[model samples]
Target: MPHLTCTEACGPDELQRLLRPRSDVVVEEPDHSTPEDAPPDAPAPEAAFRAVDGPFHHYRRTVHVLERHDEECLVRQRISYRLSVPVWGWFITPLANRELRRPRHDGTQPFWAPAERLDPRAGQVLGVLCLLSVVAGYLGTLLSQTITFAFDEFDAGLATQGNTLAAVRVGVLIALALVVLADRRGRR
Candidate 1:
């Protein structure tokens, strides 16, 4: 998964006004516990919202107003979700599960880049390549296990092929890393 964050400045009143127009977002009950590691003087989250219905619901986006002091406020955004299919949810969900966060930041004016800016076509292509690499790696492992089970001995030929597959997997992963790095750099 890729990590992304950006900051914006806005007044607390303005932030609430902005959220008021979003029909899909519903305010959540406030959490009472303060983080142990947080400063003793740190303000508690003033409000929260859940995306119960919208395009964002697929991503399970949650918004938290972490603090509001004077005219400044901080907002925290989190998204975590897995695509589910009826009965065997656990088995299939892992493949598409995603968890990401945009941590709270205090500001006086709102600023946000389009989410699409963080996920361009190049990133999607890299993700597909990564998924293919995983499948290929799994198949290679299965093949090696089957050969060993049948022969009662490790097959050096199959081992060689597995090593080649491993190399290819590493190469694909490296390419994916480079693509993500380039994308991040381009955004900056």
Candidate 2:
């Protein structure tokens, strides 16, 4: 996403020039001005509002004037949100992000640039690496968690299992050493 999205021209004042206030949220209060202590050049929020109620109660909307050239001031609006509800947040967060990232009400175009497709060869390599990582992770998890069960089947003692686990840890360190060597070699 772009560092900041621009808004339409100012309504009447500096704060009004930021992102159009969200219709979905009930602002805690209309804090329409920057704090007095803020430096004049600082991109301090021209407007800041927190949602007073609902699942999006944690939403904090801030608008900053990045560049001001008479009537054509560049405004950047940021909406930080997280649902307070426990189970509902998992579902709502993604949906909210998708909705918020694009122009919701206004006819204006989305400021976010769409992602370009990866090269076919790069995509194939990524897929193979992802699959390999999953397999490796599963093998590691299974080995650590089920070592006792495996030893029980072999009729081995606790001391043997401890020694075996210690050996496996040392093997992992050896593998890590090889990875370090490979990384240094690849750089050349």
Candidate 3:
């Protein structure tokens, strides 16, 4: 089972109230059997919240309210998910599901900051340029090879085409770098 665990501070009553209204969450009866490792002062969980929707729909999550101190409650959440597919199931599903579970900070922001901040339009243009560069390079290589094979000799003109392809690749790279730099500067 793959799981994600995190702790949050909120009173048991408040947490229960919050979970009750959420459409995806189902509150469960608190488990009476406390772990021996748990502190004696720690309160039993008031209720367990099971998240029922999203990418990890097959998973079960039990939210536990561990303790209360100075009006703040410590909550522990345990999520368990199963990968039913064969072969690469365990490896790929967990990674894909985890990515889906991750909160997207980009939200309604004009720019997405996955690694470097980039406007959506700029990113799309950059992606197109990159794809074009790859296709052009591949076509250039195929043409050069075909020409070489047909004459049983390498042609100097083919070298020019290769150079042109390389130049285009470099130009695309430079353009992408400039866009990133400009976006970073604009942020300031």
Candidate 4:
């Protein structure tokens, strides 16, 4: 299995066409974009995982083996490049050693395959329960303070107690918003 890295101009279909004729040719897609292929006009292979944080695009490109021999397999090799467009071409290979290092696949399944049923409501319920717990905790704290503290002291502590409750409410609001957004996206 010969691992070959081609330019971004080479599409998967084109690469497959190039390798399909040959029995031993193995093609591995690159992980990142290059200088010549920066403009987004060039054809880039679809990646499995993608994330955008700050100014940089963080992601991993997964190239599944289309064809392989019994003993050897094809793997995609990607070179990460930071694109400033039409300017400097900075090649960034942050985790070269770690990226190259792959775990050995023994090709055997574990004894117990515990399948999980994902209830859609479970996550939302958990988030709501957590929010309720936080609110309950704040209420409990306030109730405890009322039992021990003088009336004037309790009045002074009310603002501080309210702040804590507000923080929890804000957190719950964010969680609920996230859940609602996720639910909408899932429906789409």
Candidate 5:
């Protein structure tokens, strides 16, 4: 027979064991505590929140676990009663069931991308490319101008004179603005 123990302050392993066999577990209320500041309308957090943390099958009510470590966990759940359609890659993209930050209706498990800290390589690359593009555009403008002046009116150089470093500068600025906006959106 398997037995269980709930220490005064239970750890993750202890909690896992408790959840293993039982679908639901109620934590005993802590006694002898007075609140320094308590909301009149809101119930005590311990009493109000029934935290169900384990290997969960997602559903309408389930929140997806965004980040999880040995002890710390970050979960994201859909905002109920709001069906928002997020746009991705220049098109309206509907998220798959796995992409949703919620539990599935079925009791099947789904694979997830484990959370790892982001590195700075992507930022470094984008900065380098922007610089290079600016330089290239400047050089192209100077070349096109010189060619137009030296060549005949009907020459190809005359046609490409509109393509200048100024154009490149405009394009680069637009791209940078887009990148910054995207980053801001991600942070929120």
Candidate 6:
């Protein structure tokens, strides 16, 4: 693919537009660990971020060389996805899972979750699930806080936004009920 040239300096805003030009794609928790004490022979600055868009959710590591070759910078992106198997990827890729689950930088791993590994204790699973639900609810609230713009786009009146959210709640209920039923009934 051809590289993009920005007229102004390449800042975070410019990188946001250049790297991901999609409205639906949201890159979260970007880590730009550029070492200041590194020597001149050190490698270019690398950036790692979690991109969650549509059906594709993965972590990407991009190396953007600051050097100019013909006044153009070269960017190389590498993606490491934990799930790569055909039907059930989580069960297939044991080595990749191990690498992902391994402890990294100060007991903190970026965008990594121990999803497949579950404690057999029912109470423990319930506690974890409850915490997850709380986190998910907080995120949902954050999304709803900014949803006024979307509501206005649909010619939202006083009740429009409320009604829309109520509809979403109902949809979520139905969807979750279906999910519970699907596991019991078996869906292809």
On TM-score, the leading prediction is: 2
Per-residue CA lDDT of model 3 for 1-188, tens digit only, reads 56677677877566665334232222122344554555899655554443333323344545576776867778776655553333334444555445424323333212222333333344355556666778888986786567546544544576765676688678779988998999899899
Cα lDDT tens digits, model 1, 111-186, are 3222332222333454466577788789867865675565445545767656766886797799889989998998
Candidate 4: count of backbone clashes, pairs at least 3 residues apart or interchain: 3
Clashes of each: 5, 0, 0, 3, 4, 0
Model 6: per-residue Cα lDDT over 46-140, one tens digit each: 55555432122233434453544544544444334433223334333454334333323233323433432322242244445666778888977
Considering only N, C-alpha and C atoms within 3 Å, which residue pairs clash in candidate 4?
Answer: 28-76, 30-78, 31-78
Q: What are the lDDT scores of the predictions, listed in order? A: 0.45, 0.56, 0.52, 0.39, 0.36, 0.47
120-144 in candidate 4: lDDT tens per residue?
2432354466567788789767765
Task: Check candidate 5 and list the clashing pairs.
Answer: 58-103, 58-104, 59-103, 59-104
TM-score per candidate, in order? 0.27, 0.37, 0.34, 0.26, 0.21, 0.28
| Tens digits of lDDT, candidate 5, 108-154 | 33332113211233323434565677888887667656755655655
Candidate 1 lDDT at 51 equals 37
Write the number of the candidate with greater TM-score, choosing between 3 and 6.
Answer: 3
Error of 4 at 121 (Å): 2.2
Error (Å) of candidate 1 at residue 73 is 15
- lDDT tens string, model 2, 55-161? 44345667777667755666677666654434334544565566554433432323331132223233345446666778888998898899889999999999998
Model 5 per-residue lDDT at 7: 21
Name the lDDT of candidate 3: 0.52
Q: lDDT: which candidate is best?
A: 2
Model 3 stretches astray by more than 4 angstroms? 11-14, 21-52, 83-188
TM-score of 6: 0.28
Q: What lDDT would candidate 4 get against the real structure?
A: 0.39
